[model samples]
Target: MNERVNGLSETAVKLDRAGLDGMDRAPPQLDRLEREFQTFMREVDEAAAQLRLKAKPIWFGPVKADIDAESALLKDERRKDPPQQEADAKIIQPERLDPSQENGKFAAGSLKSMDADTGPVRAQPQPSGAPKMGEAEKAEGGSSDVFHRRLGPINLADNLQAGIRAVRRNLLVVMGFTLATNVLVLAIPVYLFQISDRVLTSRSTDTLVMLTILIAGAVILNAVLDAIRRFILMRTAVEVAAQLGAPILGAAARASLHSNGREYQTLGDLQQLRSFLVSGTLLSFLDAPLTPLFMLAVFLVHPDLGYIAVVAALLLLVIAFINQKMTASAFHEAGNFQSRANLHLDSMSRNSQIINALAMIPEAVKIWGQDTAGSLKAQVLAQDRNVISASVSKAVRMLAQVAMLGWGAYLSLEGQLTGGMVIAASIIAGRALAPVEGAIEGWHQFIHTRSAYERISVLLKSSPLNFERLKLPRPQGRLDVERLLFVPQGTKRVVLNGVSFTLAAGESLAVIGDSGAGKTTLGKMLVGSLLPTSGNVRLDLMDLRNWDQRQFGENIGYLPQDVQLFPGTIKANIGRMRDDASDEDIYKAARLADVHELISTFAQGYETMVAADGSPLSGGQKQRIALARAFFGNPRLVVLDEPNSNLDGSGDAALLRALSHAKREKITVITITQRPSLLNCVDKILLLSNGTVAMFGVREEVLKALAPLNATNGRPAVASQTPQVA
Candidate 1:
């Protein structure tokens, strides 16, 4: 079942690589090789898993096979007997004895006695499921897929139209400078063409001096103008990238609650958007039609030769296009190989101890190699195409040059063209070829940038969560849910079916349910992270959607399951959402989150910078920073999702104290917890069951309803009693 091909395996992998220096070196080639190896390992892993399954071929038991055959034979025999006339009338409602009630519970086990849909659903019952969806609190940033499919090429006409329409005063001034610079640059070529011919014919000193001065002036002006153009371009590119990235980052933020982002997305995807804005969109405008203009002009002067030049260039480019089309499947294969290869590497690195103990290093490498080989082959084929194309173009250019030299010799001898003219024509032809290759390069760049641009656009274009907008009510921590139904992700069963609950402001509420129960989804809706498909969620007598973001943000303090910290001083992070807050305010918030002491212990105290995404901090430390962020605006509602995940004992107690302090500050706290101890701390509990509130009331009352649904290690004592939330 091990699919790794030996013999050439070691030879195929070129582990040691020489760095690029002087000639005979390239870095990208080595990188490609390494990537291919990694890709092979990924392929080997997947294939090995599949082949292992195949190797253990299933053998239908002899008796079972015979039973199946006999069953078929008996069915045929039954068919040969005339079909029973009353076969369809075999419905039976067998009489059953009712079971006795054991204590307050119904002890009868027969499913036939139960009528699940016999009456109206409970209008106001308690919720019993655990509120927290996952035990771990997540970091603050949202993850997403790497490649987002675009809706064809972007219609730039809209952006272009708007740009022209919104031609602001500053932009017009910059445009004028750009136009003036272009005019000056274009005039140089014309000047050269005219002066070269005239100087060759007459050899006038005055003419030469003037031409020299003109060229110098043009060069100087062009450089200065280009600097300005670059400045403008930078501004424009940043504006566009931001215009594209902000909404995308926003969407990613919006999607963070439901998506863990492991499938196919990363921060790199968003960076691609920025890159495309600066390079791809701006450069592609020249990719079309410019060649035709040059060809038309050339044809007017030399009908046959111009046509040949155009034909040859066009034919060369056509080959490149064909090669690109052929590489699509290869590129896709390469991408898959790359992803799996990376995963393999990550797994190997993270589980080095496991591999070391098993002494499976060679096997691990071999597996990685197996995953990556196909992609390597594809890439090798692609590289071959590129090299061959380059070599062919070089060959073709040689032929054309030979022809040009021969033609030029005859024309010079006949006195139809001068030696200098022949040289000039040859130079012009070479210039034409330079751009042809550049055109192809430009095309390649376009495809890359376009790919990235499309991803950013998708993030921007998605529909936001639905929340009905209503006027703001001073949040008093009170909440109510009536006739609520929730379907947790990846399951057919509902976690909360016909659930209802109510809570007073400045009070604490705990949601408890089975692991898959819709506890997290319910909490998410309350925090404006998700919208219910078929119900209304209101906050403080106002619809969530009705309030502008500023108002909602100012009033609702939501702590996500994952707490992500930006790379900055502790004070800076707390003051981020409240720009006007001073150092004292940030310190106060940090103190409330119980992280001020930790900040003080750092070498820089409150000024110590956290590495990007808080890599320097432990999970517990990161969560506290996030809690500090939640407290920034003195919001009335404190919604915590698994805040105690990384804390233990005294830490947990301290976190609970913070929650209690929030309540004392008149801020309502709704927390999701699976721990029984945390439940005891809350005033009320909403126990969720089968996508409905099983019970809702004071903690003791809700616990009574959920007594039958207690679980161990997150699984129900009985399968049917468990809610399918995940």
Candidate 2:
């Protein structure tokens, strides 16, 4: 062992000397040295293993001393030449060695001559047909793929399936309870049979008392189990709601965006689904499958009685099928009419003030009444059919019970069955048919719930939930629009086309055009509220569509033509309803919008509650607050459409101040306006004519070009074209 160690030390010294002298060693010599080093390492490993095995024995002391001495010698040698030892450590570090380099003639650190001249080893060229590390994991669908799968599809069916999976254990437990409950249902019939066969025949008071107590106990236990089953179902409904509510709402919101102002009833649909979960209708469906078990029980009592129960159940099912066929179309029509009527009523309610002032209530009511009347007529037809079917089903059930009793009595008289068996058969037969009757009675509810489920599924499929995007750094306010084009959904009319422009960081541009020039649409595309049919809107060279929505929103501020505030405190509205927003941010936004003093005059100041309709605050106040909301968090870009339309003189002055503040902060600004006041504050002007760019250049240049047209037309050229821009 000592001789081997000496030989290894001598070889290392020779290698270090060769490296210090910068001698270019041949590949063969380096390979030979590498083989020797590997053999020495293997020997050291074998010696360590032997020492470990001998560690527990009395002879281990000499081996332990030899191990320590070897370790000390290695440490002393490492200290003698720290830099060389460091290079050796690098060679031994598994992570530092490139696996691809292993196939080359010289292994890592095999050429000691290069160690003195090179800083770190370079990666070797990979062999042909070999996958890079990243490509290999990508091919195997690694962590990123797993993340995407976890996101899943945002459709209703997948979300519902996920929710069901989450509660699968609870569902299994509920099924167990249902089975026990159904089995306990036989206690009534058994008690009746015992009373007639034992107590009546014996004429024993003690027997009657014992039978009463047993029947009472069974009834009590059955009720307890039923209660527990209902309780579990109710809790399951809540859990499902908690799991699905947010995703459903998010999908609905996205659906609304692409729906051309069509409103979705998704929340109502979700509520209906939750209601169905805990309804008696669900319990009836659950028990319907167990009907055959009850029929089997009746068969055990008497084969003739079992046959009667089966026929009755089959008859009721046939009736249910008939009822569904008779009313399905009517229920579907009613649902459509009801949805239309609701949408009409909601629109009317939002415009109630206008309707009343313009004496349009009668016209509005007439239109709404037509839709309501159709809905009611369809509902009436469905109800009529439902009632008739239910009545017939009830009659059939009663007659079946009577027939069972009559047959049992005849069999008893024939000396084939006991009297106690007669009443028991009647009760058990009724229990078997109860679920079928319940199904008939609740058929309308089942239809409605099924329709709701289908509608929700369609809504989700039409507008899938947004997946998480990678967060990019905050933008520096540079804007680029490249040949952007937009056509509204479901229409052939092009709203905007071939609109292209650029704005450096902190530059401001005013968009001026005719009434139908697509200015609002362009604004929406710029802020990513509306997607373009082609081309791109880029901020900091990253496409707007690719930016993480929440992060992107944080960097951009937008005030639309109609400024509608959300229902919350003034402070919340300014902070975009984020709970984490600090008071300082809210105040800063308020001050930037120049509405801080107006807000302070309010009794609640920043805490003042505001409605969605902008009550308690005037139109000017609402517009100003909305401006503040857009300016919140010191957004890199701000877009304002008709910002001063409702502003008074003071409000207009405040708007100018806000624009000046934005300029000082180097925030990019885009305003859609026909007002000369706004144009004066902008660096450039984009004149849109019929959705196409008419002129785009420095503000003074564009205005000078329009000067002749204004003089010739006897009016301001932009304002004459845009009569709707107040």
Candidate 3:
């Protein structure tokens, strides 16, 4: 055996060297042979190790028998005094005798597992210096417990702040450009001074040409710098949007699941914020700080010109303040009205078919017109105030320029200032007040952007991003709902109260209830779409909240009552929009839902386009396609609410076949329905009435129980119950 092992090792080394030397030249057969030889060598090594373990001394049997008997006796004693003896018991077994040794001597390491009827070994105390488990987990990231992974609610405000920090470098570059551009702008006034004092007095055409060329070059450079600053700001805005876009959309999607009739204006607010970033308003803010520098230039010309510039700036500032005070409330009110108008418009667009079919367009328009009129009225008021303030600010600025020129003229006549000084001071004074005037003009936009920022901040705080959850193994569809209770937000009515049920893997349950009897709510709770106000929903002994949402979603399938497909190819919709879904999986899902042949009848087949608003296809077709989507990816659990609501006879037969297929595949299913035909395909029935369980048992037993109730009431048990739950 040893000789064979040595020979194999030598052969492996020779093969390795040969493979490296002739890797490119080696034939496919040679590579295959090499792999086979390596696998054989591994098997030989394992077999040899097992043989060595089995090889023992002939005289070791008696000693092993004695140890086995002793072990058996110790086990018996432990059974008699189970708790105390099991805690304190430690058994010693004789070590395997070395095959080469004639004398039976134990190895040195054998004492570690042995104890001679000693009392329970006291656990070794942890060293004072060592951190406890909880402390270690905290150092890593709070507790390892599912409910307390973080120290407190996630600080989503920091997430928004972090996006700004990510673009800090670009902002700094913009600021540098702003400074350089402002300094270069001084060239115009300086050129005016030189042309008036030097060129005109000297009558030197050469000096005139030089000053024009120099000032033109400075103007061009300033334009180039300004363009670069704007480009940088635009890119920074895009980058910030990209950084926060996914997280914001994810939060909105989660918020939609929990709330009803709550409009999510986060995306629009983000767009407003981004537009403000790249707008001229931001540049005006940057230039406002350099206004004092321009004022200082005017001061260098003459103190009286400086004083005029200061007064103009002060007056403009006061006008801006008045504009803000007057228009702030109006703009805010306009924004609120505009949001409502947008919501109404979106609803009308989504239900355009219904409006057209019912000929309700006139009434819809009138309703939306009211909201639009309110928004327009508030906006018109705000704009009126803004225009008035801007006109006053403009008058103050032009008056200041006129005052500077007139005063300079008087000073020049009195021989107190030069003609060049008069012209330069007038130009410099206008530059000094340009920022304040521009700011006044853009004041309304500034107010809107500030309002958007505040709204976005509040939205983020209310709907924090989901925390990273630990990935758990795929569940086997063993569902246990224990005393579930749910009450809708901002309402006193209970939708589901003390609803409890259990379903094992492969079982099919029919959840039948009257309209508004909480069947849909129960289905949502089972699929993890809606959280229970109390009690637990466990899958495979693990709480639903403990599983990562993405992973949990991948394992469970859901089809809501209103079947809506995303705007995409039929193949994509059936594949649940997953880019990675294979052709085989798509075909299998369609076949399982009995939709494959129906889809094939279309001209484009699976490649046919579909819209969220049902188009081209009939209501039954949409329901069938949605059913296929639910069965896609072979989900372990499938929840279908009103699965057969739009199904015809043929579609109903297909659904029955699908349910049977699900049972055969051991995929647990919870079907919410009012139709009695589906109950025949299910293994069990759960009847709900007035947000409580009316009856729950095996199919025959439940039907038998309901049979007497039906007879007494002269109607079906479910249909007889009144709608009480929301």
Model 2 ranges off by over 4 Å: 1-158, 166-169, 260-263, 716-726
Write model 3 residue lDDT over 540-632, tens digit each, in one string: 657788665666776778989998999999999998897777788789889878899899999999999997786878989999999999988
The stretch of ten residues in a row with the least summed lDDT in candidate 2 is 141-150
Candidate 1 per-residue lDDT over residues 1-726, each given as its tens digit: 233344225434433333234225445655665676687778877665444332211112123224664466446535644343123222212121112322333343421231243321211221111112111111211111011122111232233233333324335555566555645644454555556578867889898888888878987897897667556656765665444444444456656556553223423554554464345334323223244544554454345446556666776677668756755555556656755776687668656867999999999998889778866876666556655665666666556656665676577787766565555455445445544555444443444445545554454444353222222323434455546666657776665566666555556887776776777777777777776655655555455655544446656676777677777777777766345666765766776777777677788887778876575778887788788888765566778888888876767777877776676665677887776657756778776665676667876666654555455346454332223211
Question: Which is superior by lDDT, 1 or 3?
Answer: 3
Model 2 lDDT tens row, 1-726: 788778867876777777735456645566777888789898887666444432211111112234664467457656656774553331122222334344454453433221222222222444322222322222322111111111334244567777667567676777778888888888888888998899888999998898788878878888898899899888988887877677677676766767733445777877887898889988888788888988998898889988988888888989999999999999999988988888888889778879999999999999899999999999999999999999999999889989889998999999989988989889988988888898899899999988887776676666644544554445667788989989877899998999999787678999998899999999999999889999899887678977756668877899999899999999999999987777877888888888899999999999999986888899999999999999987788999999999999999899999999888777899999877777767888898988999999987777777877776777644642232222
Residue 689 of model 1: what lDDT? Answer: 61
Root-mean-square deviation per candidate:
32.6, 16.8, 14.2
Off by over 4 Å in 1: 1-235, 256-288, 332-380, 411-418, 463-473, 488-496, 560-566, 572-577, 582-632, 703-726
How well does candidate 3 score on lDDT at residue 363? 95
User: What lDDT score goes with residue 692 in model 3?
Assistant: 96
Model 3 residue 285 CA deviation in Å: 1.3
